[model samples]
Target: MTHPENPSTFDTVLVANRGEIAVRVIRSARAHGYRTVAVYSDADAGAPHVALADDAVRLGPAPAADSYLDVDAVIAAARTGGAQAIHPGYGFLAENARFARAVADAGLVFIGPTPDAIDLMGDKAAAKRRMADAGVPLLPGYQGTDQSDETLLAEADRIGLPLMVKAAAGGGGKGMRLVTDATDLRDALAAARREATSAFGDDTLILERALLHPRHVEIQVLADTHGNVVALGERDCSVQRRHQKVVEEAPSPAIDAVTRAAMQQAAVTAAADIGYVGAGTVEFLLDVERRDGDHQAFAFLEMNTRLQVEHPVTELVTGIDLVEWQLRVARGEALAFGQDDITLDGHAIEVRLYAEDPSNGYLPQTGTVEAWQPPTGAGIRVDAGIAAGQQVTAHYDPMLAKVIAHGRDRDEARRRLADALDRLVCLGVTTNRTFLARVLRHPVFAEGGATTSFLTDHDVTGVDLDPRDVAAVAGWRQLAATADAERRSPGLAGWTNATWLVDSRPLRVGADDRVVSLQATVDGIVVTVDDQRVLVTGTPDALRVEGRPVHLTVHRPGGDRLLVHLPHVDLDVSDPTGLPPGADDAAGAGVLVAPMHGAVTAVAATVGQQVEAGSQVVVMEAMKMEHVIRADVAGTLVEVVDVGDQVGVGAVVARIDPADTDG
Candidate 1:
């Protein structure tokens, strides 16, 4: 192992990224005694990564195009900061060949693959063609340059039904659509094209025949500038929603020794063929239906020309710090060991924790993280960029953190991950923590049989909120808040006449508007919700509902807002008395509001136009993903917001006159 005291080629490195990846790279760079520099946008001036770095530079505003994605600005920052190299992390311009070339032209090393390799693998169509020429098996698809809608439609017909339309210039499930019917082809193409153009500046797409119940697996490949390439192992990323991976695990349960060896060899070959250097991932779609002994049919997907978000699982299993290896390779170092020296160990599983709601159709959420407490234990690891009081805006991806667990076997790993997820407490915004925990504990996932359609085929999103638990926590929070107020105001406490008076408060919990009534008594408090009552005893720190102790963490982020964090559930409690009449209720029946904070990219609805329920009225772009806001009730549009307008959650974008109304 190389020691930190040993001299390296680069003495200082600039991380041209933000969030957790920047923090990860800075940690690795500092561990090797290299000075680290961080770049931040206006929104991240006080972010953890900024404070962690030895030096920092301000880029621009919050939007990535003006900040992180601006190659000139990033290079200028690196030069001004006296950085010898730049690490692009996983997103932004990490896989951009032009950015890589710019860094090299600026006389600074880009801590990733060569510009040629990135360009070759960055284009899905070109990469697929190259892999096919190299004798790599590929799924039947179209990768031609004729991108006209007419040509694409014809090719879709020729390729047959159930095809996947994917963006040729990007991944991360953006600009990808799965079309199973001919009627949906045109709409899918338009949506895919719009998203691709917005995300990657390219509307070009490729079509491939959709595999039946396939396992989405990718092999982690590492190579240096020298002639050495090795595949660490494979990761199963089949548990997905909207083609975006949710859960991933190293040493895929579906893969046997024979299949593993074949996939590894193919991945290494693909890397060498592209002259790949540094860390890259070769993704493949493994057909679960085609199984013969240890051999399974698989086809090339596309190569992620940089370190993957799920790289931690592979690192745990192989005992390798991929970022360190990337830095080493960027310094013109050769691979210290060959494939023969690489080995895999215990099982590891990772789940992405996002600030989105599964029940609300997985809409992205934005707000301040009033309270954040990730789990901590021997086998639990959390790579998160968020902290208490940090704002989660619509400027970036909704993924807040990643929680991983490693154990001796799959079951142990699964159990540990589930427990860790249950222990996590994130408040002041909606999240997918409960949904992820449910999936991890589901029978199909536990048995290692989850496919790409796991989310589609299962009811993992529905979390039955127990009114008892909600009321108990709400009552506890109310009493705690009263006690706090009394401590601050002795006059108010004296006016309350605590010995003779019982104060009653009404609070609303969750988006469903479930109301809980609490009454403070001399002996603890009484909680009532929907005709059910329970006696809560003990203090705020150790509360008992009906003689049963419950563990809870409470945070008050302003007037009437209480965040109660319980096991496997976090409830946002608000005082209904503090809200204007009907403010806590759902939006008016004929109004179409923004489901989340985003820019209105398209408005299909016009005033005086009649539309049916479920018709898409507005399309919003946020967190690099597009969401179509549909009409909740059939009506004639009376008012409509225009495109290019930035809207907040619950802001009315359109107003419609109900079809049954005479107005």
Candidate 2:
């Protein structure tokens, strides 16, 4: 399907990215008869994408600045790999105009839109102006060149309250803040600038009027050098957490036939207006009145000049390979079909599987994945970067995979996706799999009524840690230790031969630590916690808990950690009976622990400074987001880590001495 009009295009492609997207692009490129090259950092030497590529080149160290974001390093890597085309997957430098230009200067074809299109749309302010000029409906706000703090504040007044202060240069909510009150505008502006500068290296700010309870939807468009453009349906990305999309689907339940057509035409027009080429997405903010209002119901949000993370949903629904289309377009291929030929066949849903705990404000997690088993069934596809023994580091985003499902209808797709998520067994690291299932099956979401405020508006936290799971883990420890002892010395498994000996085991699961009493017997294993005795019988893997057979998978990831998978829950519990409790424990309340591995970006506490309980002591940056570490109890600061200090998860960043009670 490719023509040779573009001299820069070639048979070899260098994927200038990492993680799942890198794996995705490499697979597509190879499948389409192109040689694939992968670039990796020191931390990702054994990554999935690198191993899958026919050739791979090292970029730099773990930090993105020294690795993926380095324009010269990427271009040099392409040159060394002898790749004629470079594919910058989503994130990192995908939307970086300078990176695109650098690829062209290296005589390499960038498998994306031109540098001009990237620059025009990458900057939110400029893209909004351009879209407005194209007669695209847009929300009223400030998108001017003036980025001064005073001027922005003045403009906020004109735009009214509940306006968004966003980093004009990037997406993914890195530098976005919602200001509902006038008093919080200044702080929001400062925070947004700081975050924007850290994430995108661009502190340019733009203000947009915030819509209440809106849905996030975007249109997928492809353009070729042959003056052909086509719209490939739409994707709904309304379910979000912290402004980042957590779930996406195609053939949005909210959009009707009339609205879909209008949105599709508008997106096609937007792409034509910018003279964009290759694959791109035009995002919009859809108000609640989807079908009633014509153009007034929706407004242009921003245009992603690169392949989106949620593109698989659109692909599944449209039965198209967007990556292939991008390659063909870059190689001067004409459109094989037009908009009239495009059609949505079915409903598709995709959930972002992240290495994070949903109960703890979705704090990003990092560790070695001891075992990973992605779900497999009809209409299910998983685009993942993780594997058994793969290390999930703190240097990058915590998203480990994308689990997608498709069916003939929305309900079938929803249930299928939920079931697939439940069956997914990824141990060693905590994830939001259960939360995702809950969101899918929730009444609002099930009825296709979820909006951007779904996460905050719903009670998605009803699932509790089953007592039997704790007991089962305790029984597993006893059985495992007994088996190991018997392996080393026959008939030396337990101290007592007449009766099973009971032992108390300290187990910790997501901030709750309990001492479980259990005994292993020839008949079964008995565990008691909270005065409840639970019986577990059967082999280690196949177990019947409390006389009821339960499906389970367990992995010992060294030390005292045990990853227990039970149905829809995967609990990474640490057996702390032999090891001493760390300083972050409740007994050491004055110690402020780093929740995750990150660099200390700010320090508010100092030695000999008086502080109160719940006061911010330090702020750490990881995965391009800032997390504040606060003191646990009232005390005077005695020890505090300075800025630029790299700390690991559970590392104490600060210590406070209890205030003198004599006073």
Using lDDT as the measure, the top candidate is: 1
> What's the residue-level lDDT of 85 in candidate 1?
87
Give the CA lDDT, 0 to 100, for residue 25 in model 1. Answer: 87
Model 2's TM-score against the true structure? 0.94
Q: Model 2: residues >4 Å from true position, as ranges?
A: 1-9, 290-296, 479-504, 519-523, 580-590, 604-615, 631-638, 656-663
| Predicted structure with the largest TM-score when compared to the true one | 1
What's the number of clashes in each of the models?
A: 0, 0
Which window of 10 residues has the lowest lDDT sum in candidate 2?
A: 1-10
Which digits, one per residue and each the tens of the lDDT, describe model 1 over residues 79-140? 88999889899989998999998887777888888889998888999999999998878998
Local distance difference test values of all predictions, in order = 0.87, 0.87
Q: Candidate 1 regions off by >4 Å?
A: 1-8, 292-294, 478-504, 514-524, 581-588, 659-663
TM-score of each: 0.94, 0.94
RMSD of each: 3.2, 2.8
Q: Candidate 1: deviation at residue 571, Å?
A: 0.5
